[model samples]
Target: MNLDELDAALRREFTGAEAERRVVVRQAGDLADTEKAETDRGVPLTVDEIVDNLSDAPDEGVASRWNWWMGALEAAYGGYEPFQVRRIPKE
Candidate 1:
């Protein structure tokens, strides 16, 4: 999904400052890139897939949900740890 779609999907699940939401979208784009490279099946993770993955996340915030998703990816595939959203700047 494009940034706009990603942003909208994120909006449905997460409530946060606009600034924070922007950062999450940017980071999600980076994760998309990483998924493109990591996947051997040639199908990158779609926006729907991402939202579904985050749906079961144990945390409430956007950043936490993102980190949780990336954490799962990291466990299944090494090298995804770097893509985890470590810090979301305060708005």
Candidate 2:
């Protein structure tokens, strides 16, 4: 699913607490590239810094957001492809 669809699904399927946590996790995952860039530059990154960077990043395209959400979901749930998703609880 695309990012907008995924966001809507998360809102629908998750309670307030779970939705908040999902946002945190997704934001963290989104910072992966920025974190790598910082590491390459020999700069240390605090959690807040990473989070802020992620928050400021562009989310203009459905395709980019889809990839981001898929990667985050895969890392959290252990696979990107739906067929590879085990008997985990839907989130």
Among the numbered candidates, top TM-score falls to 1
TM-score of each: 0.81, 0.28
Candidate 2 versus truth, CA RMSD in Å, comes to 11.0
Give me the displacement of residue 80 in model 1, in angstroms: 1.2
Candidate 1 structure quality by residue, lDDT tens digits, 10-50: 88877666676787788777867766434733656777777
For all the candidates, what are their Cα RMSDs to the real structure?
2.2, 11.0
What is candidate 2's CA lDDT for residue 53? Answer: 38
Per-residue lDDT for 1-91 in model 2, tens only? 1334435543443334444545534543454434543454365544444333334435533233334544554575544534221222337
Model 1 TM-score relative to the real fold: 0.81
Error of 1 at 54 (Å): 0.5
Q: Where in model 1 is the C-alpha error above 4 Å?
A: 36-43
Clash count, candidate 1:
0
